[model samples]
Target: MSFLPPWVGLLLALLLFGALAAWVLRRGLARQAANLAQVVTGEDVQAQAHRRIQQQHLADLDRALTEGRLNANQHAAARDELMRQVLLDQAQAGTALQRGGDGVTGPVRWGWIVLLLGALSGLSYLQLGAQQTWWPVPLSQRVQISATSPEQLAEQTRVWQQATQNRPDDAEAWLTLARLQAAQNAHAQAEQALARVLALSPEPDLWIERAQMKALSAGGVYTGEPWQWIENVLREQPRHLNALVLAGSAAWSEKRHAAAQSYWQRALGLVPADSEAAQGLQQALAQAQAASPAAELAQGVAAPPSAAAPGTALAGDARPVIQGEVRLSPELQKHIVTGATLFVYALAEEGSRRPVAIWRSTPTSWPVRFALSDSMGMGAPPVLSSLAQVRLVARISQTGSAQKQAGDLQVELPGVKTGVQGVVLDITGR
Candidate 1:
C-alpha cells in the first residue's frame, strides 16, 4: 500500500515470491505422485498412448517393406526394431515404476537439492551457531612470522621505493627500506635510504637513530650527529659493536688514543677483532696512542665516580651484612638482606666448602679477603623468572691500596628464590 514504508514493501515482495515457489513445488510433487499411482495400477496414461501411435507408424512402414511395395530396406529394418522397443517399453512402464530415474519417482533435481541444502545451512547457522559461541576465536596470531630472507628483502625494498614516490615524506617507509636493505647487506642502497631518512627534518629522537645509522655504516661519517649520538650509545651499551667502532673513530679524530683502545676493545668483544671494522679500530688506536697519554690520564682522573680516589678507599665504615634463618616461599627458601648490596654471581667451582653467594659488606673476621664485584660492565643480569644457583661474596676496602676481605659467605636454597636484587654502591666515594 502507499502507506507502507519502502522496507515493508520489499518484505512483502519477498513473501510473495516465497509463496509462489512453494506452490510450484507442491504441484510438481502432486504430478509425480499421480504418475507413480498409474505405474502400480498397470493403467496406461498419455505416455503409453504416445508409444502406441509410434508403434502403429512403424508397423505401417514394416508392412510396406515385407510386401516389396516400397524401398524400405534400411528404413523398414529400423522401423520394425523401433516398434518392438515401443511395445516393450509400454509393457514395462505399465508393470513397474522407474526408481530414481527420469520417471515419476526420480530423485529431486540437483539444482533444487543444492538450493535447499544452502538454505538449511544458512538457517541453522543463524538459529544456533550465531547465537552461541562453541569455540574461542583468538585475537592475536600465536606464531610470529620472521623477517624475510635476503632474496625477498631485495624485492620488498623496490616496492617500498615505489610507494615513496606517491608519499615522498613518509619517514616510516624510508626507515623500513633502510633497515631492510642493511639486513640484506646492500650497503649502498641502505646508505641512500638512510640519507632520505635524515632529509625528513625529524625530531631529536629520530635524529639520534638517523645519525647512528649514517655514521655506523661503512659509508663513513654521516653529517647527522657530528659528536654526540654515538657517544651516548657507547655510554649505555659500551660493548655495542657499531657503537664502539664509532666511538673509536670519534676518539681518534680528537687524538685520544687510549679511549680509542678502550672503545676498540669493547667492540672486539661484540664482533671479531680481525674484521674490516677491527682493522680500522687498530689504525685509530695507534694514532690516538701516539698523541693522547696526557689527555687520557686527565680524562681518567676526571671521572671520580668510577676511579678509585688517590690514597683514599671507601670513605666510611663498611656496611655490615646480617644473615639469619631463611624463609621459603611456597617454592623457595631465600635469605633476606635488607639495606645491603646484593652481589649475585657464579662460583669458579660450586661444591667448595666456602662462600658462594656474596653481598657487599665491610665487617668480616679474616685476613682481609677482598672480593671485587666483577659483574659491573656485564651487559645483562639473569632473568627473575627462572630458578638459578648464584654465588656471592662481600668485600670492604679501607685504603686505596689496602683491601680487606672479611666475610665471604654462600647460601644454597630452592632454585626459585626471590630477594633484593641490587648493585654495590661505588663506595670509593662513600
Candidate 2:
C-alpha cells in the first residue's frame, strides 16, 4: 500500500468541499431555471388565453341576444358564467407572476447558503486543526533521535521495549531501542538491550554500542570491561569513530593520556575540519596533551633555574584551567531578546561568590567555546589554581550583571576539577 503525501490529503479535502459547493449551486440554478420557464410558458400564458376566449364568448352571447337566435335569460346566464371564468384566470395569472419573481431571486438565497457553508468550514478548521503547523517530516529526520526531557524519554523507552518484546528477532529494533534507552540514562537497561542484539546478530556497531552503554552506566569511567569491549571493536575496525571516541574518553578519565591522544587523533582525521565532531575531538586532544606525562616531562626538562627553584613563583603553583563550550538550549532561545550577555565563570566549590576567573562574551549562535585560565583572573591573588574543585557556570544575563537574578537562563557544572575540557553546558532554565 502506498501512502500519499500529507498535502495531497488536505488538497483532496478542499476539492471535495469545493465540489459539494458546486453541486449545490448547480442544483439551485437548475431549480430556478425550471421555475422561470414554468412561469413564462405554462399556467400564466394559458390563463391569459382563457380570459380572451371568455371575453369573446360573452361578446358572442350578446350578439346572439341581438339577433334573437337565443333567449335573453340564456345569454345572461352564459355571460355570467364567462365573467366568473375570466376572474379565476386573472387570479391564477397573478399567482404565476409572483412565483416567477421568487424564482428570479433564488440565486441570492442560494448564494447566502454557499457563503455560510464556506465560512463555517474555515472557522472550524482554524479553531480545531493545526492550520499553522503544517510541515514535511522526512524519513531520515523522523528516524533520528532527538534530545527529550526525562519524562518524555521514559515514555518512548517503554514504547520501544514493547515493540521489541513483540518481535524478538528484530535486531534493528533492539538496537534502536537500546540507543533510546541510553539517551534516557537507563544505561543498565540499554546494555541489556544491546546484549539481545548481539545474541541475534553480533555486528561491529552493536559491539561499539555495548561499550558505550557500559561506559555510561559506570559514570563515564571507561575502564575494565568497557575498555575491553571498545578495544575489541578497534581491533576489527581500527578507524571506527564511535569506538575510538568512547575509548579516548575512558583513557583520558583514567589519566592514560597517550592512549587517549592516539585514539582521538584517529577519530579527528575522519571528520570535516569545521564540523562539530572535529571541534569536540580537538578539545579532547588538547586536554589529553595538557595532561600527558611526556609533555610534562618535556616542560620540566626545558625549565630555567628560576622555574625549578624553591620559593620561586612556580614553587607552589599548579596552573589549573577549565575549558568548555556553552550553548543555549533550542527550546529556551525564545526567551532571549536583544541586550542579552553570556557570562561564563568559575567559582570555588565551597567558598565566596567572588569568581576565581570569569570571561565575558556577547551571545552568538551557540556551542561557543571559552577557556578560563589563571590569566583571566579578576584583581589577581586567589586565582583558579588555588581551588582544587569549583563550579563552572554559563549564564545569560538579562541586565548584564554578574549577580544572578530571576528570569536569567543558566546552567552549572559543579565540583569540576581544573584542566577539564569538553564540558558542554546547556543553559536551559532559570
Which candidate number has the best TM-score?
Answer: 2
Output candidate 2 Cα RMSD: 18.9
- Per-residue error at 35 for model 1, in Å? 99
The lDDT leader among the candidates is: 2
> How much does candidate 2 score in TM-score?
0.39
Q: Report the lDDT of model 1 for residue 132.
A: 41
Clashes of each: 12, 0
What lDDT, from 0 to 1, does candidate 2 have? 0.68
- For each candidate in turn, the TM-score is 0.24, 0.39
lDDT of each: 0.44, 0.68
Task: Summarize candidate 2's per-residue lDDT along 1-430 as a digit string, tens digits.
Answer: 2246556656667677677777777877777777878777787568667867876887889899999988988888887887787778778778777778586447675776778578757755753476544444322123445535547766877887899999999876787787777664456677898899889877666787787667655544565888788888889899887778777766655656688789889888998999967876776676567657767776774321321221112211224277678877778877777767787778776533345566666665677777776534332224575567788888887876544556878787888888777788877787
